[model samples]
Target: MCDDGLMTSPTHRAIALLSLFSVAQCWSGAALADRLGVSPRTIRRDVNRLRDMGFPIEAEQGPEGGYRLRTGGDHYLAVLDDAQSVSVAVALLQAAAGAPVTSTADSLRAIETLRHLLPSSVLSSVKSVHAASGTVDVGWNVPPDTRLIAELAAACNRKVRVRFRYCDSRGRVSSRDVEPLRILTTGNAWYCVSFDLNRQALRSFRLDRITELTVTTFRAERRDLPDPVRYLQQNLTETPRWPVWARVRYLAPLEMIVGEVPRLYGSCRSAEDGTTEVTAGAEDWDALAGHLALIAIKLGVTMQPISPPEFSDALVRIGRRITSFGAP
Candidate 1:
């Protein structure tokens, strides 16, 4: 598109080329030359210029060969227009608000750097919107390490093997060597779905519980796997590791309970009797009872315990304890 009287100098042509490479995975030399209105020889020279400037531009030989920019390189600067710049600023602000413990500082520093680079007029508008907007904590008490997440993401993208020490929910520690596949978030924490080499099965690890992470040099062959997000959802919902599973019927509408409960934490549905049913898991009956108690307190409503005699007994115990607290 820049070939239409906009690309005047070689520098402008190179910038245009960089912009093109950023959007798509690969572009043939002939197509690039045609788009830039330059000779194939000129395109080759521009590619070389970009490589010399520390952009990891990978070029292949032959007719079907093309050039692509690789991610996780040592140097990468995104070229953004004014609107794109404003969008990035807004996204960074949101990220800073919800980012994990270690990454909040990084997000704030990035916002500061981008503000300094933005034009004065654009910066003024961004500042006004930022002043009007406020952030709420998402209640992420135990978030994953930012550096570990980056490392695992790079390994997944590069298709490499990684080894890490993992502590499971039962406090059992084990060393795991696996091929990192995908990293997903449950709005509160991060999880990595990987193929476990030793166990010979697919596994999902909570990123916060991982330690001693090491990315190996071995290239991992891609396996015919199911959709990653689906796999993660099934793993979380179907195979809960908690010991106690309970269902409670809240005397509220389904829509109201759905907004209050995160999907990753529980599943909610409307009962035939016009109450909302929520099925969730907890480490023990006491913990489950406490959670339900907190919900009742927060919503100022009643919850009919659906099942699990243990949970009901625990609730009675908790009620007696509260009654005693009032007496003495």
Candidate 2:
């Protein structure tokens, strides 16, 4: 048993020693031995092994005698724990899903490199995550400019103001300056949550619609606003008070349809007997019926319209269309 343990334990001990050295400036032999539950002699042997691998581990002799990864050792190699490796792999997969053609190629190459380096056990878990997870395109074909996204992220991190030329959905163009607060991703689209300086209100700008982004030297004044994620969700679901709204109940659980449907379409809530109720607004009965039909198809559940007879009639018309597909 002792001989078997000796053979299998050195690799894990070496990895733990490296992790400790990476995080701290120095660790004494006694301290490392105590931490790894090994003798000072074993710690010395592991340190020597790490040095043999070109880790640039340094030792000093004195009352404060210890070991450390030498200065510039970071330039030699990078090491990742299991969790960090899995994080990188999952992030690369997500990036590849939404990235443009060229960026996707680079992300794939990095993922392949990670797979080659990660342990077989960890690589299996990473592959499972990749297999179970998926990205919804939401019909966005053009990926946001990576440079612009990076600049906006930096400005947000620094709490700075940025100026950009924006074209709204109606084809109106304007130059605006704003304090970049947060960048949010809903599906494949990216939106910048900002405090518009000119309008003196919070605004969400779609990244693809923004151009000529310039991060200014001016610092941003913090404002008391709702949490960025909650604010975005509210803005996405908020509808005009006077619009035609319909309430429908689905024979499905709230978790089943929560994120699958965009918040812009409606708000979902749990109902009695494990059903979900969706309240959505539309320009007219036809539009509302169409939305409900699409939601039903996506959820694979029967929907019972709760209000507005016009909406029920419109839903019947949609049902006819579905039946016509099978007709001669």
Candidate 3:
């Protein structure tokens, strides 16, 4: 009988011992026996079984001594449970579908690795699950250079400095050297948040607008900055100071209309009365009014323009256009 008074299979006991040693680093025979609900003698027998299968389990004597898995000439194959296998398979499929262009090769490699590792039955089930799943691809506003993104990502992970040419919205191109920090994805675009070494300030560079990316040998100096996601949210969502900016208050909740509009187009605030205030900027009143009308129509709610009179006039013009349509 095992320590818990139940018959334990040798396979189960060996796997348990392997897991325990992997996690705890070392475990005495008595501790292993207690954990597995077996005797010290059974633990020894299980260790021997693992050794026979080429596991490098080393044993030592004394109070501080126990069995430990040591580095050996042989490689260790992962022993995954059913759930783990399924999870890995599912992840591989998803990555194959939606991973960035830069990561496509790596994703494919991972998928192939999982395909070889998983059993035939599990692979078939994973395939079935993948075939049934669907995703909508709205496409990126600007496709980033895959190789540049991959290099920058690696540089960020390694705390390295990188130099790159950047083009601003106004078409002004400049060279910049920055300490790679974090990469952020928002509103169908990727931005690299980095500390600009030349400017000595924090900056966000759109991956799509980056060029001539070169990783430097110099390690980056850490900076005190807000969380990567939060910083990106604040910078990315700031309304542009266009000449014809307008604020509109909508009767519906913010959540009802958020998905219908792009975050770059406006900033929204919710009120206690379930109403939403949207502040958007555009080059002209007509453009702003058209967006407002679209939002009102999409949400099926009334919106009151609370800005420049030109916006209200634009709405009137839209109404006139609608009323005059198909008229003699």
Which candidate gets the maximum lDDT versus the true structure? 1
For each candidate, give its TM-score against the true structure. 0.59, 0.51, 0.53
Residue 248 of model 1: what lDDT? 92
Q: Provide the overall lDDT of each model, using Cα atoms, as 2-decimal numbers.
A: 0.71, 0.71, 0.68
lDDT of 2 at 47: 89
Q: Where does candidate 2 stray beyond 4 Å?
A: 1-142, 168-173, 237-245, 251-264, 272-275, 281-291, 294-301, 307-317
Instruction: Give per-residue CA lDDT, model 2, range 68-98, as digits (tens).
Output: 7664313332466656656665566557766
Q: What lDDT does model 3 reach?
A: 0.68
**Local accuracy of candidate 1 as per-residue lDDT tens digits, 1-328:** 3445755577877657755664565899989988888888988898898777655688888887899766542334345555555556555555666777534554555555445445665555445434333333223445545456556766887789999999998899999999988766554566788999999888888888999999999998778877666777777766666778888999988876777765545678999988899888777888789887778778887998989888889999989888899894
Candidate 3 lDDT over residue span 108-156, tens digit each: 4554444444556455544433333222232245543434545666677
By TM-score, the candidates rank as: 1, 3, 2
Poorest stretch of ten by lDDT in candidate 1: 131-140
Give the better candidate number (1 or 3) by TM-score.
1
